[model samples]
Target chain A: MPINYYIILSLTLFVIGIVGVLTRRNTIIVFMCIEIMLNAVNLLLVAFSKMHHINQVATNPTAGTEAQLFVFFIMVVAAAEVSVGLAIIVMLFRNTHSIDVNFLNRLKH
Target chain B: MTIIQILFWLLSALVLLSAIMVVINRHPVYSVIWLIITFFGISGHYILLNAQFLAVVNIIVYAGAIMVLFLFVIMLMNLNKDMEPQKSKWLKLVGAIACGCLLLVLIAALKDIDINNQIAETNTGNIGLIENLGTVLFTKYVIPFEISSILFLSAMIGAVVIGKKD
Candidate 1:
């Protein structure tokens, strides 16, 4: 229930996501890891927002809502990124017949 | 510990475990499934934070829409386990080490910030409600909202252009 618990949990999730991005060979899995990272941030933001709201209830009623708003925008941006990213990945797969991101370096030629 | 604390710990554990499975699972489909579980666990966390609106939206966007999109891409690609070319063991080792270092650094940095005992309850009232969110979003955050729409428009166009066969 403490803020630290939420922070630590989200941080662990974020690190897991980083590991996935670094280690995964498949482009799609890498993208999934990026999503994981985004979700981790969202979790942390909501927790902080709640904590601030509880503390500042009398002073500012809407203090915490902004973080939730930010989360909404993040989701929107994520959706957009996924659309474009998946399209690019699909295009790459079509051309190279492999979704391995390391295979993408050869595109320079 | 109260019921809320118990629920929080359970959900966090579920999230962490499924997230690990997502990364280590050999099959991409299984990875996707585990990722959905992770998203669900996050949604549970949002609910525990008394942000019911966010909890619902998290499920709708991440688990429902985005995950389905991922599954469609995976199935369309006809990806199989054997087709997944493995990265070198050295690369995996390096990744694990780097991630471990980062986690340790973050934990160390955060150790000093002493948070008091303020447990989040289930009902935090109107701030998280749809009406409040909508009022602030349309009035104060209107510009960013419009910009996000434009971003979506461009992404749509880009997807169509790149996805089209040459």
Candidate 2:
């Protein structure tokens, strides 16, 4: 398969994630959408890394693979972020007994 | 189709399908389960890209650690499927239109970009062994790398403070 295939796939996934985040009232699903966007970008970065490696455009694969390293760090941070985010959401649910953002009316001025 | 290509397609399909389930499923437990599958599929993609270290880290961090926390929270709160509220039709339409436009723009912009028609020439001999990864992590990018750990430590502290009893 062409590497562009992965790019297009990544684009599609990103859009789906955007749609989810825009429409979903549930905080957990919204968090999942954010994760989706992160993964889509990781795929795109890896695709570009392969492109750079294949065309011999970059002299050092090590440098080119920096994108992959960046992605690894992103994943680590994402894991950390999601755990905390989920905890906060759970805490909110314990008090409010609901997950919908629209009904979070107590914060309204 | 050759074996490797076929495997790639299969893994991609699994990932995409599980991701869809994560969005649409009503039960939070089911949704979390689907997310685990999604993590597994992403790890498979990492392997296909010849990043064995990345694949392992993905599984360890996401599937093993992060997901355990997700499940813990899900169970701690005892979320019910019936508690999930329905979004309005208008919001759905707005989201779909926004996403559709975004997808169209991305596809249009990428039309002229061709990449990796040929497989990358990788030194599969070493294939980024752990020693190589460690060398780069500690030597060249050591400062930023260590700084990121400090960042993570701060995040962990913040999470603890935020999550303390009210």
Candidate 3:
């Protein structure tokens, strides 16, 4: 598997996620799309990490392990984001009775 | 092409398809289901890459925990109905155009990257294993790990605060 295959796969998923985030009306769906984008990045990171590991002969034999570490941190942040984001979404639904993001503008008043 | 290549293509296709389904599905429940399939497909890719630990962790964290959280929120909100009013056609069109442009730009930029010189093989050492990763995580990446704990604590407090009735 050439590295380009992974790159293209991740890019396509990322593009799909971007489309969802931009066009979706529901806040939950938008948030899910962001998760998709994050997963796409994770896939890319792991792929590059594997590539680096294959090429490593002398420099830091454990090259690319850092990328996995980064992925771990990303998951951590994402977990935290999900908690706060869903809570905020729940609060919005409670107040507005609708999860449509357009209603968020009403908050400015 | 070997079995790994075939598996790679199959899993990538499944992931992309399910992800698109996740975006196009009107119901949040259906979206959650498709996202789970997408996570499974990505985990298959991780296994193919020999990152067994990540594959297991991805399943445990993403497919198991985060998705259940999403489904719970959707059920709790009683948003089962197709209540999400459609966005304007213009907005959808603009979004599609922007996404297409972004994809093209990304592909163009990727073409310049010199990554094909390396051979893709199952030669990844102990890097993706549990023992090695744990050693690195506790020794080198310990500070960031501790910080993530703090982040989780703050997020928990914020959830409790925002969720409390006013």
Worst 10 residues of 1 chain A by lDDT: A100-109
Residue-level lDDT for B96 in candidate 2: 86
* Candidate 1 similarity to native, TM-score: 0.95
In the range A9-102, model 3's lDDT, one tens digit per residue, is: 9999999999999999999999999999999999999888988887884777788889888898898899899989999999989988999888
Residues A1-109 of candidate 2 have per-residue lDDT tens digits of 4676687778877887887788777777788778878888887776566556556544664545566677778887897688578767876887888878777778677
Worst 10 residues of 1 chain B by lDDT: B116-125
Model 2 per-residue lDDT at B153: 87
Docking class of 3: medium
Best candidate, DockQ: 3
User: Compared with the true structure, what per-residue lDDT tens digits does model 1 show for residues B1-166?
Assistant: 8788788889989999999999999899999999999999998888777788888998998899889989999999999889988989998999999999999999999988766466444445567778899999999999999999899899999999999998
Scored by lDDT, model 1 comes in at: 0.89
- Estimated TM-score per prediction? 0.95, 0.90, 0.95
Instruction: Identify the runs in model 2 with alpha carbons over 4 angstroms from their true place.
Output: A105-108, B114-128
State how far residue B121 of model 2 sits from its true place (Å): 6.2
Name the lDDT of candidate 3: 0.89
Question: Candidate 3 chain B, which ten residues in sequence have the lowest lDDT sum?
Answer: B116-125
| Per-residue alpha-carbon lDDT of candidate 2 for residues B14-116, written as tens digits (9 for 90 to 100) | 8888887887787878878988898888777777777777778878987888778878877887778777787888888887888899899889988875543
DockQ of each: 0.75, 0.53, 0.78
